[model samples]
Target: MNTRTRAAIIGGIITSLVIAVFAISLNSNIFRQSNTQQNSIQNNVGITSKLKVVASFFPLYEFARNVGGGKAEVYSFLPIGNEPHSWEPSIQEIEQLKGTQLFIYNGAGMESYISKFMSSGEFSNMTFVKVTKGITLLKADAAEDDKEILAQGGMDPHVWNDPILAEQEVTNIKNAMKNVDPTNAQYYEDNANAYITKLNTLDNDIKTGLSHCKKDTFVSFHNAFNYFSNRYGVHDVWITGIAPEADVPPQDIQRVIQIAKDKDVKVIFSEDLVDPRLANTLADEVGAQVLVLSPLEGINQTEQQEEKTYLDKWYQNLHNLRMALECQ
Candidate 1:
């Protein structure tokens, strides 16, 4: 072969090697970029697929959480230990509802600010679920002095205190979950049914537990237990009006003391989140002991850390009531 031809052949071989290397490097870079983009898209889809649920209070949060199970992410708008009757959401907290799909609230005048939010048209994309929609609300059994305050919005919002009504709330929440996330309808249905079964058992337990009590009337810090008392055939003589924060006038305190003495009440009940001083004073005046009768509106951080549920709190309340009533 001629020298020039040999040199041409060697140069051509080198040029072929360079082109092959460049092509391989380009293909490798394209493959990595494509893989990264696909992963990013999958992650975004995973996040958006889960239903975002925001509950107004503790009991509603519990109900929604149970119904939503794994398909939804549930949040409580009211922090633990805050009184729901007087709690007002801040602007930042309100802004957090932007991407939420469902907002579950107990709407029988429980949350005073809910109406403003509903009318603002700010959360048009979110579906608002009033768990108390189907249940019949009881009149707020407020004190005579607070009659005007109670009469303005006479309906009681503590329907969840009644286990039967709680079942209805759970059903409402389950239906809402199904409506928003139709693909997971059966999953939500199954979870709700299981929780409802537990609630039914709770109702039965309460009825049987209170049936044979020696006393039918009990004293409470506030009128939060009207639904519970009404359902179980017991009477509650509350110190304050519908809300725990309502001022207890001296006259009303004397009135409750007289009622407690006449009824031969052995226990004066205070709530978990309320100041126990009033109850202690009443108990001292009436020669009775003070016990906790939780409203289950919200629990403290310790209880939350302990993973206490509605059932746990109600059962504790039942135990306390049985002691107070001297149940057989």
Candidate 2:
């Protein structure tokens, strides 16, 4: 080959390589700038990014979401259908709390492990909300008739069962959100007010529905209805004790049957999430029908897919209770 042709070819190849390197460098800079801008927006424009909120259970999840009004990304620590009463958080779940804007949980001893989480002294930036505050707590009677043996901390954490108290819980959640993400204060408050109104309506409906019942006594599988019974003037006779044991004693079963027979109960109620086999045996023995009563705890995924609200579940409870008690 001629020297002039060989020199031209070498220069052209070097130029092409230089051009490719420059193009790559420009592309990398653009990519880096795009990432920096995204990170800056996430950091500086907090409201533009959804607030990270964590709820201990389903009821809290619903309340938080309703109050946030699609502005917050609310996640429930417990999955759908999990029984919150006995749930304990895993290490990974605890790690998630570190980045959340708010962590809302029903107090009143509902989440027994929360104290330990607080003691960890980590996640100092996260705002922890106890929705059960500013409300009266009910005592858990250790057993149906015997009050001598008080339960774990002896506080009934099922205050959400009472709509009046539930209103307060919803309020606490709203206020917490407003505090964390102050720009949306009015939005959260408005949503909270609307939800509280619905809860009020539910309370009235339940009162009116159960007012003229033929009997006020209804049987339950567990004693998680102190506030509901007290608020509505209904008598709840729970088959199992406040804390159900693995093997429910024969006497306890006999007592429930006797109560059903004495009160002329047509139906015996069991918790939806719990095993109803024991209640089934008692119902069979007493010749009574069995109904599943929700304590308004965490709902299953199926119920969520059906879009069942707390009010809907409560209404169903009232309907079943009226039928069981022969309400007029």
> lDDT of all predictions, in order shown?
0.85, 0.79
Q: Which ten contiguous residues of candidate 2 have the minimum total lDDT? A: 143-152
Give lDDT tens digits, candidate 1, residues 1-328: 9999999999999999999999999898974665464344334432456788899999999999998888888999998889888789998898677667789998867787888888987666678999988787877666343433354467777899999989999999999888777778899999999999999999999989998989999898888888887788899899888888888889989999999889999999999998899899889998999999999999998999999998999999999999999999
**lDDT value for model 2:** 0.79
Q: In order, what is each prediction's RMSD in angstroms?
A: 10.5, 6.8
**Model 2 over residues 1-328: C-alpha lDDT tens digits?**
9999999999999999999999999898974665455455335424567878888887788788899877888888987777876678888877656557688988756676877777876655567899988887777775333222233346677788899989999999998877767787898999999999999998999888988878888898777799999999898998766654335678877788888888878888887788888888888988999898888777887898998877788889888888987878
> In candidate 1, how many Å is residue 107 off?
0.9
**What lDDT score is found at residue 72 in candidate 2?**
86
Rate residue 158 of model 2 by lDDT.
76
Top TM-score: which candidate number?
1
lDDT accuracy of residue 223 in candidate 1: 86
Cα-based TM-score, every candidate: 0.83, 0.82
